[model samples]
Target: ELTNRSFEDPPGSSVTPSGWYDCGFEGETPPDILPSPTLNIGKTAYHRSTYLGLTVRDNNTWESISQELRQPMQKGACYQLEVYLARAHSYWGISRITGKEANYKEPALLRIFGGFDGCDGRQLLAETPTVSHTDWRRYVLQLEPALKPYDHLILEAHYGDGPMPGPNNGNVLVDSLSNLIPVDCNANPGLNKNPEPEFAKRQMLSPKEADRDLPLPVSEAAKGEPISETQLLELITTTAPRIAFDPAGNLEHSHYTDPLTNKGKWANLLLKNILDGLAQHPLAILVIVIPEKDPNLAALKKQNLKEALVDLGALQEQVILRDWLEKDVEKVWYGNAESGVLMRLIR
Candidate 1:
């Protein structure tokens, strides 16, 4: 970009080269960003040969990875974020740092449009925990469009504490960038499907037959009327741990994203209204009226909330509603029936 008048890093380094990527020397090439301290990964992760390389500074810190893709997301539109991540080093002993060091947590950061002019797009969406093991894992996250339209996108990864683990602590590799307006279902599902041992229970709490019920207790906090929020919170506090043992839906995003979606215009208003009704009591059940045109609505109505720790402190034990065929598919129900009347849990 020397003669072409394109952007370059802030001085002190060699002149900009004509290539697909520009590494950080005295300073990084403008636009193309770095996710870490050292810039030396191969151009691509699973390419025929070499992969872009970057240096990891410490542990539990996030490195922002971004690109100069000039796509302006509308103010009210929704967008999905997706990328692939893997542990940098294969050998454990060869890692940069281990526990209790600088890069302690080995965090990975996937950022979007972080440091660009005009737009304040520091949307660091997804994070991978301290990765001590070696093996490539793909992670995807969904982000709402910023209030202002942004042209650039940033991707990043961070090390929590010290250096790579004792020869074993190594760099985390991230690649396969995919985002934008293209409606790719696999890219922006807002869910992590593979974590070896998924936190999802087989199903939500379901009744054994049709009228099974498990209700909450009366603690004299209120009269013989409806349950109180303080009492409900009290019950949840005692039961969060017990339910955590059999976590079903998303534990993290459920609280973080779900609530916000309900309030936003981009979200499904019908579904939000149904959920609002169920919150009246401790046990909430919601049913969706599916139309024939939207066959996928059946699938979407089901909540396979694994890592988000959904349905915490469910009154009854999570019952797996068996199907007639009993194939690969399984069903579940949530309910509470100890409060005089056996009220089934809302879906």
Candidate 2:
């Protein structure tokens, strides 16, 4: 039910303790004495308990810990704290296969830390509460002026040194350490956490968006701009006095146009395209072959002859000229790509 969570760290991940460095692992690890600090992987804190036995990966790295908060949370915020704690821990044992141990042992911690700051990597927040036995328990903390709510939380061995083995190197099992509080800052300000979303969108569409619905080269862009919609439309509708095409797909018109002219642009465009195609060769022709020799081919040819009337969904209906290629492809003569004579035919 607690709303507080370990920010920055994903749930049940060892990386929860990111953004800081140099900290103690356990209060009192059994059998030997060694501390090299900064561990790879398994660097997160979780809830555990001897009652629940060792949580598979206990392996000792299961010491309870917490992340340092960002800053001073707003004063009057509705706050809730949920700590997944296991008053006991047993990630490892001094018994069985001891690399260099004679006695196996693990201890439960008093309290875990939560929502804290000061990252010299040696700061402690809320102390864990002491627990006993094989059962599990949950606890909540209310922010009060008297106790002065802690900004951070830790789930490792309690702050002071304890003799019962619940010390710095001892095992501490904690499920999750979280706190959720709605800050009521007097001066509300927007948080700048992870701003890549906005920047990413801009970068993705910057080039294409710059030309959309815009006349090219009008403002900042140096590239020649697209013609105005009105001008382009007018040109599409206008018939040209004469048209010529060049090797490059461009139109050369004898008629001069004033600013904002679009009188015959589309017709001009169509003609220009034709000229462009023809420029590549003396003549450009499309020939479609419909066989007339074999019986099956003839049947297919007959079927093609009925092309003007194509099936139009429903049961079947006459196909419109635009809807059927046959009417437009009457072949000036009947032939296909294989006919040398048909290939020479032009519209």
Stretches of candidate 1 exceeding 4 Å from the true structure: 1-44, 58-65, 90-107, 113-115, 118-121, 129-133, 161-170, 181-347
TM-score of 2: 0.29
Per-residue alpha-carbon lDDT of candidate 1 for residues 1-347, written as tens digits (9 for 90 to 100)? 01111121222212231222332322322222212223332222221112223334422222233345455555545555433444543212122234343322243333344335423345443344544433333344545444455454544434433353422223454433334433344553544222221222223343442221222232332223445554444433333222211111111111112343443111222222222333446344322121112333222223322111133222232322221233322433222211100112333
User: What TM-score would you give candidate 1 relative to the actual structure?
Assistant: 0.34
Question: TM-score for each prediction?
Answer: 0.34, 0.29
Candidate 2 lDDT over residue span 11-124, tens digit each: 222332343332344442211111112221132222211111111112334333344555433344433343433323223333223444322123444433334353222323
Clashes of 2: 59
Note the Cα lDDT for every prediction shown: 0.31, 0.29
